[model samples]
Target: MVSSPSATPASALSAHAITAHMGPCAILHDIHLALAPGRWTSIVGPNGAGKSTLLRVLAGLQSCTGSVQLLGRALADWPRRERARTLSWLGQNESAADDLTVYDVAMLGRLPHQAWLAPPSSADHAAVEQALRATQAWDWRTRALGQLSGGERQRVLLARALAVQAQVLLMDEPLANLDPPHQADWLLLVRELVARGHTVVSVLHEVSFALQADDVAVLAAGRLRHHGSTQDAASHRALEQVFDQRIAITQAAGMWLALPRLERPAAPAPSAAAPVSA
Candidate 1:
């Protein structure tokens, strides 16, 4: 189900013959993919399958052997500041200074839009407020990042990414430390982004959540196994095969869920008859 570049000239993002190496080990093989505009795509795979690596390459934050196009133009050709303005990235467990206020942390996303040594504009403040509210972290705007719980920190970081207001967002393990309700909130946020014609690419370990994306990209051993609509049979087969069929994809409550295919624990052996008689 690999998407052909020829079919999508105006893709939001496209990679061709991408290969990445970490030291002497090749982490990602040749991968060709094109992600549609105004859509959400989730990358899912087993550990060490290069999901994060692929995302880094897409963000132009990692060195790879192939070319990536952003908005139909060569990624490498874009100026650094311009590229930063066009793409926002949220990495797993991203760290910020503990003493920085939540609002200050989110303001970091506005750097690309500001001139050298210039102060944040009114628009910058507005964007940060909107982003913080979107993540439900506005009430803690004045609080230090260190004072918050892990989930709270995650939401603030998400706010920072959103404040960039980029055309495309690349998030890796964005759901880390989030509770179920917050995770559901993230789902709704992504939908809102897509509806506005923004492109979102996320690496999600939660397969059920991944299925909620418009498309799924399943990888294995650093190779692209499949990239297609979430409802496509081929995509489902690839998912099942990649995880060794230890999970079953089923429909429940009008949404897809990837349930584990494990047998119930065997009942404990009955106590000795002598103990019962006593």
Candidate 2:
């Protein structure tokens, strides 16, 4: 389903002067960022900071004021079919018809590759099989989506996205409703994609998970506060400032961990040196 560009660019994605509004309430303000090819970038922010909104704008799912470029071309200039083949989006709480089998749901990703009203080719079948197996969702291929648990359904959705085999992938809050082990599996999947020369952008609420990304973009109050390499001191400072220093960062086992600062009761001050009037 992925589109092969005539030529690849130095940066896979870029956004400039993006501002989005929902019903006259601004959600993002003058955002500018560029994502490198074949790298993983995570967007992190406090709730209501418009992290997801910014992602939508980049994906062309949301109308906003600004320009987003993909593969050295303006995003708006791409044909719809070509765009679909070049970018795959996995949004939060994605839902499909409850009666659709997992296989059928995942096979929908092949739409971009299929001729209209034509039967799926062997290529489509192969892609779906690989995707399902990758996510370990093959075991339930014939099961209807409604029959699966939230985590299981999430896996199926992820498989569908993987089946697209896009050059650039965007996911919004993909970790929601996943257990710790499954979350780790998702992380591995992302790394494997990046290693294979796919660019990935995800919006993550988990600061620790975001820290594992190659780069992080921090947003606060609908504005971009910082965008830099994850290990950079400037990025860490932006994170703390955005969160009002409620969390602390510690490096352990070659990874950064975000832990909340536990509030403790203040001790009473001794009665003002008991007024021994000098």
Candidate 3:
């Protein structure tokens, strides 16, 4: 069933006419979005479509024009530590200190709540353990970041974000290195987070996976093309259009599936009367 904003608390994040530019290029232009608490929203588009830029702006990591409110207050008004406690961000290609163990990296999420010079508290330990287990990275907690495979490291990064237990989570290309099974696990984890009253906004390349979100926002050429429930007909049309009409959405096994167009093999050309000219 499509989740409605009425069912959630006031929006966790809101943006209006938000514009961001880098040098002479405008990465995001006049965008508006509202993320309800306990909902999952996916922003999707082709490459250079500004999906990542928008996430960064929403996370307050980039400078942008227009209004951005978090928890009903201007985002800029929040202190850094307070904002960190409210917003957890996972960038497209996150880097970790290679020497740090997975456990140490995940524990870093507690920095906003911890006293300076103090070690991790019991609550912090519990949160870290739960996050690790939730992301299925508990077994690799002792491994150094440089030792894990790409997919394993990605899971550990997700564990770190979850360990924050923030009200709003922003993730970009979160499924980059994950296999199908792990992708499914990630979806389940997102749903669990929303069920627990956390708000999630992710820039996802997988249209099928994005379609599973409570809401979908399609961007094209740095402009929002559609923003609404996944079940909306307009959302599907926008999804198809943004992908250059190569993707078709259909129902199978009671689930929405994105099917890509396959090119037909060309028939062999008839051979000219070999050597007829000779």
Top TM-score: which candidate number? 2
Model 1: pairs clashing at backbone N, Cα or C within 3 Å: none
Give Cα distance to truth, residue 110, candidate 1, Å: 0.7
- Could you give candidate 2's per-residue lDDT for residues 162-241 as a string of tens digits? 89888999999999888999899999999999988899999999999999999999999899999999998888888888
- Model 1 stretches astray by more than 4 angstroms: 1-9, 264-278
Highest lDDT scorer? 1
lDDT for 144 in candidate 1 is 100
Residues 37-138, candidate 3: write the lDDT tens digits.
678999999999999999998888889899889877899999998888889999978988989999999998888879888999998999999999999999
What is the descending lDDT order?
Answer: 1, 2, 3
Q: How many Å off is the CA of 7 in candidate 3? A: 13
38 in model 1: Cα distance from truth in Å? 0.7
Error of 2 at 225 (Å): 0.6
Q: Give the TM-score of candidate 3.
A: 0.90
Relative to the true structure, candidate 2 reaches a TM of 0.93
- Whole-structure CA lDDT of model 3: 0.89
Per-prediction tally of clashes: 0, 0, 0
After superposition on all CA atoms, what RMSD does each candidate show versus the true structure?
A: 7.5, 4.3, 5.8
- Tens digits of per-residue lDDT, candidate 1, 197-240, equal 78999999999999999999999999999999998888888999
